[model samples]
Target: MFVRTVYATGDPAELGTAIRALNSEGRDLLEERPGYRGAGVFVDRNLGKLLTVSWWESEQARHNSDEVMRERRTALLAPFAGTLAVENYEVAVFHVLPRPTAHGGLHLIRLEFEPADADQLADAFHATVVPRLEALPGLARAALFLDRERGHGLAGTLFTDHHSLAASRAAQAAARQAGAAKVQMAVVGLEEFEVVHADAHAG
Candidate 1:
């Protein structure tokens, strides 16, 4: 699957209403697009920024729907422009596995790393971490991306809940013990966020 995430910083006063409108627009578009899978909107407690993420069956599908998405997003945020700072991202990797929970919700985790460690981290994640986590229960997906223009390397995972996140971490630790640590290095000076939200596209 392909993942696209957009981050918007909104005035505290207008945040709630803005997020609702944006989420509604996204939901409507996703519902009409065949390749649309799922999505969620998360508000950061500390920064008060909102992150909107969606999954698509392919990059083309996402691109094909861009015009409509742009129009909807513009209309949704017209009233909140002065209160919001918007940015969109094209996800480079999206790996989908299975969620352990039968309840069908999604837990999302995003990590942003320094540019210097991008290559090594990406390699380590794909070669070691990804394979191990992919085997764990509730690990619905994993994706890695390099945003050189923005000096960021992004990695994300989708799970059913805290248990799945814990399991995935444990699996990664085990992989490190098994000699995957050489290529991997702890990511410092990074920003991370964890969010739990309902699957807006759930059938």
Candidate 2:
């Protein structure tokens, strides 16, 4: 699977309005596109940042939506956005813990690491990271996406709520470090986000 993410920063109030507009205008349109799978919006009200991600079956499908997405973004977010960035990645692993109970309000973590030794990284994720994540308190789901040839990786993790996420910070930090080292990779970026709008079909 392939993924595209739009990162934006703006006023909380304007962001709320912009997001609603996106839902009605562009979000729904994605589902009608070829190879569309799912999408989700992640925001941080206090930080005034939002990250929207959409899933596609292939790079071509993702690229096909670029023009329309660009137009929509320019029309809707131009006034509200302070900064904007877009990125694409290949999904290496997508795992949802069975029977997740805790619900409502999600604490999301996005970690990017170097992708050296792709095979080793993938192996370590399944053997080490997966189990640790599944055992984490209040974890809902986690996915690791990588560009094997480019030496880039994106790890997205969702927690049940703020407290649950904060409580696991220590352990998560340790695991992140160990995992990166195991694959001879360096941590490039790590950020926290709030899941603002999620739907049944969202990835």
Candidate 1 stretches greater than 4 Å from native: 78-123, 130-142, 146-152, 157-189, 194-203
TM-score of 2: 0.86
Per-residue lDDT over 1-203 for candidate 2, one digit per residue giving the tens place of the 0 to 100 score: 88888888988778778778677776777877888887777777787888888888889998998767777776766566899988888877777755332332344445444545777777887777878877887787777777766777777777777777778778778777768667677666677776655432335
lDDT string, candidate 1, 1-203, tens digits: 55566666656566667667765765776779778877766555456566667766776877776667766775675554454333344455556654433333333434455567666666677776677767777776666655545645445666666566665665645754442354434333323344535352322
The Cα local distance difference test for each model comes to: 0.57, 0.73
Which candidate number maximizes lDDT? Answer: 2
Q: What is the C-alpha RMSD of each candidate to the true structure, in Å?
A: 5.5, 2.8
Tell how far residue 16 is off in model 2, in angstroms.
1.0
- Residue pairs clashing, model 2: none
